[model samples]
Target chain A: MAAIRPGALDPARPLAAVPPGDPGDPGLAESVARCLNDFFTARRGAADPTDPRFDGEVVARLERFTLLGGKRIRPTFAWWGWRAGGGPGSGPGAAAALRAVSALELIQSCALIQDDVMDGSPTRRGQPALHREYAEAHRSGSLRGSPRRYGESVAVLAGDLALAWADDMLDDALDGTDRRARVRAPWRAMRTEMIAGQFLDLHAQAQADVSEPTALRVARLKTAAYSVERPLEFGAALAGAGSGAVAALRSYGSDVGTAYQLRDDLLGVYGDPAATGKPIGDDIREGKPTLLLAIGLRRARERGDPAAADTLRGAVGDPGLTDADVRAVGALLDDLAARSAVEAHMRALLDSGLAHLAGAPFAATARDALTALAGHAVARLR
Target chain B: MAAIRPGALDPARPLAAVPPGDPGDPGLAESVARCLNDFFTARRGAADPTDPRFDGEVVARLERFTLLGGKRIRPTFAWWGWRAGGGPGSGPGAAAALRAVSALELIQSCALIQDDVMDGSPTRRGQPALHREYAEAHRSGSLRGSPRRYGESVAVLAGDLALAWADDMLDDALDGTDRRARVRAPWRAMRTEMIAGQFLDLHAQAQADVSEPTALRVARLKTAAYSVERPLEFGAALAGAGSGAVAALRSYGSDVGTAYQLRDDLLGVYGDPAATGKPIGDDIREGKPTLLLAIGLRRARERGDPAAADTLRGAVGDPGLTDADVRAVGALLDDLAARSAVEAHMRALLDSGLAHLAGAPFAATARDALTALAGHAVARLR
Candidate 1:
């Protein structure tokens, strides 16, 4: 039941380090997509004949939504983490690593579907949010009940299904791997942290907590551990890596993940809608307590700029905010130096993460690819 | 890695067969409660200090709601299933069986919480629904955003946490057991089936499908499998039971489970709020696609009584139906003999289930205990 095959860890045979393409995975993305396609195809076919509509309504939509679009960033990090931990570049072991890490995307699917219902977002990845789509179908199909409620209810079940299926996928992936127990620890932690992070995000909006500390904590739990650290740690565990390498990967993951979320904060306000696939100024409209907003608000009050502070307070959480209003607020933030301050912070975090990677005892090739990933994570437009 | 200890399966040394007191488990209840208490206590204490609010708002409430009350029906069935499969009466293996079965309660918690939000239920188990509670707090505290939206959002997250924690609890229970993979198959199927069943229920309501077949299908998936069959099968799997015994238990579970749902439908329309802990006629008001309503409608139509059919249809799914309207519908169902028909069907189901038990090679004590459970399941007022 050994996870690694003999000579798999030989220094002379470094793991593959495929370069990412244009802010996303090129080579690994297909493998991940194909893996998911096969899995869902089987699931779809297995839909009970007693309820044919279940397949059309739920299973089909889930398959389409999952295969629709994602950056595949989480799986990429996990794959590289496995490679860095001395897993062979090819063979059943490597294939299992790919399948195991692909489960992260299903987790991502659950988060996004649930988040949309919670936020009442209109769109995701340029398509109507899953709930919104279901709601629209209800309206058009002349279905009974409140269309909005029906949509949200269906979406919740859909998210729950994805979460359950993700666990099943992980179990399938670990079928014969001796590292199942090792991978379970991080996987379990990641799921709880994801839910806890979401709760905090909701609370921050409700209580209007705009503190930088709260913002960072949310980013660390919601994004850092979930998006980077745990995925890397999970992959390393899958390879049975020594504690030293696992710790280093975790350190690097935390820094990079935080930076990545910070970058997302910037994108939420400034990134093009076409690229980010989100409405402009959604964070402001939803009153999300991101680090950038906290800094902006703090700087305004500290500088005794009551007018700027008042403008921010008035615009945030205002669902009726117009695009023109958003542009004006963006200008105000820039004038207050909040945008530049966050950018500087993001750079510092990324630099620190790379430094961790530099000192880690990872295979030579994984180190190079990891550097490229850190760069793309922070610098990407979307 | 053997699941059973040597000599643990001796027929002469039968497992404990504690009689259920009143409507629920009296003997096993305390053990399940203590196991949950210790687990949640550890979880609450482990809450990160950075977000104290999360602990109070999310984790603590989850702990309270889980520990507050439940009939512990699923766990009781699982325990009996284990005994029927020849698991030891008491020891570490027995304790693990209890711990593993208790996870069903958490899953129930998740199902109940999310269901309230979906159904817009104001109360549950004689208290405000979790979402309603959160909504009241938002209004009283004057929190940001729509109180309704906030409440639903929070409830969704709470349910997600419960589901995730339930899995972790099961994992902990299986840590030293050799039956992890065997237990996993049923566990995985049950999770998907639960969600899928829920979706079908929603769909039936939305589509206005009032057929008897659809009603039975929904009951089979939602209640039969999730509440009874899976618990029995899951427990049997934990004991490493052979296929013949497992099949018999499943047959017994399905019959009893469907009878249980039929009883629930009757109670929803006719039972006292004092005992049922739900408002009278709530199901008709909410337009739930229950077997009783479907049968009543079918019988009315088949008897060439359009007036009766119209009255039944008009009364059902009417949100503003008065208490008198419900009473009229109940009288109409009785006059059509629909009530007697359902009662007969339930008796037949219970008899069939008991017959399965008689045919199976289960221990004598377990057989008697399971028969009592079946009677309680279908005959109780609640």
Candidate 2:
């Protein structure tokens, strides 16, 4: 295993960039942000203004959700990966790479909209979720009938539009001869894994007979693929990295992706509402069938607590569960060692991922950026 | 305009390669059908076996509703366009083209699934629409919970999955060096236009002030871009067509696509329920402000019939409107010469589209195929 050391800075800081907010980094981030804004603007321009289907509200919602705030981790990964693979950061190729990276943001938007709908979450990025907003808009007497249905329909459409736009942006970015084929494989894989992962996730939740092993498999497929490995591989592929480099990045990515998901599971149950932008214990209310839940179930059974099992089943989908109940459940999870098991898994994953990256043929600066990214991926818990 | 001639076969048939119920055409048709089936199967394989999210009923519903029973015009356009652009029909390139064409079918599926949700249509392809099926499944006590919501959610996820798969399938098919760039442009255009057009359609419906001219523009952008012109251009692009050829195909495609959409509008309002697999007067019930509606509104206003205008608006969204009332509205539409105007526009479009094709440097066979396609584009009305 790689001997990884914690960075000097607190890993829990949300943004990847430091507090001084590197003047140089922001410029690149701004460029990417500008590219994203321009891309959406041009997209809206392509629509017929007279069509009632082209809801400005829909576009506005997407823009606000997508453009507002998130760590531009994927784009940064792409940039760092390019530099690592001996590609320069300032040329026509670089611009194309950045444009391709912009696609990550669009993909993220697509995922979030669908995720919001799937999770039935009421808010996103400190605002009402798209579906909730639409539903509320219906209540305001602007639209006629079935706000819930309208919200869902519009959200679905917006998501579909974003997904299509992502492809278009990627195609436009890779229009050049040099990077076209090289970018295709990773681009395709990133999309496939996302969809496959989502399928696994939805499947795991819906199945009554889900086991602990099955839940872990679901997490690996759903969260791991798009979250880390694919993003890293996508960046590496853009740099024309060979199979060996790509494979190493994949290993690193998979480990980090798994760790990231495991941490997300932890946060889902125990994280503060203010930090997570979700209600405390929302996952438990939704019966998320998460890794923590699986572990807790196992532990509860091992302790011969039939009442605990019943309590869990009742609490899983109970929207009325209170903060006190949430705390109690959190304590039970901790007592059951579910939290520690996940943390241990995350640690092992981090070690394996960093170890793979240590021997990768990356420049020192690139290596540091990646290592920083890995630290950031797991920094929330620490 | 190109010369019009009478022949043993109806010129109105969209493609001359195969007639309705001909066995020889079934080979290619069957290949397409099988390809589509296999595509869905391969995709479904990725789903978890135990998850009710992959419920047999939903899969069966999707297979029954989305997978089967399309004219496969887009794929045919794609395949024929490639052949016309100098790609052989039997080589690896041709096979790849076929796969790409199959991807179009999947895209169409994505579009239709969402379109049903948008329009709230209760049936598709002679069966209960996906959402309706889910609703029914819930009502029948087979699946518990909000079936309507379940249907919509599943459909949205299915559409998302299908859209992602379309990209995957396209990538798999276009795994070649020579035609990658050539194929990418039109492929990207098709995707962008469809989404943009959908937005325009939605936007147009919300604003009561949408004019006839603007409605036509929306039709051109949304329908024409995806249906005829873009599909042909996509296929031609893969075969390395020059600018002139591409431009000619675009012009032809634009006209044909518009005419096709116009015909569909007519069918939506007046076609037999059995034939269209839509309830009679669906367009009226949904208040779809289609081109036909625009023409009818214009004519109604021109005739100084304020009462007719009021009646039109009042009757549009009335789900409980009687069959007689629907027929009466249909008659009023015809009395205002809306149908005639649409037919005139269709004829003009067909003429203009064929004229554009006439000047292109296409093989005689391909040109003939296009001519047949144009004839078919307007055939149903007569």
For DockQ, the strongest prediction is 1
Docking level of model 1? medium
Q: After superposition, how far is residue A245 of candidate 1 from its true place, in Å?
A: 1.3
lDDT of 1 at A89: 74
DockQ of each two-chain model: 0.57, 0.31
lDDT of each residue in B1-382, candidate 1, tens digit only: 1123223222122122234332233468777888899888877776755267878998888888999856777887888888888877688888888899888888888899999999889998899999998988989999999999999999999998888888888888888667789898778767777888889988888888778998999999999988899899999999999899999999999999999899888877777777677888877887878888899999988899999999988876788998888888888888998888888899989889988997898877667778877766555332
Q: Model 1: per-residue lDDT, tens digit, A105-150?
A: 8888889999999999988888899999999999999988899999
Candidate 2 Cα deviation (angstroms), residue B326: 2.7
Estimate candidate 2's alpha-carbon lDDT, on a 0 to 1 scale: 0.71
**Can you write out model 2's per-residue Cα lDDT over A21-123, one digit (the tens) per residue?**
2224455557778788988787666553524345366666787777875766567666666666666667677777788887888877888898788777788
- Candidate 2 error regions (>4 Å): A1-12, A18-31, A38-61, A77-96, A132-141, A208-211, A358-363, A380-382, B1-31, B34-67, B79-96, B132-145, B208-211, B302-307, B322-324, B355-363
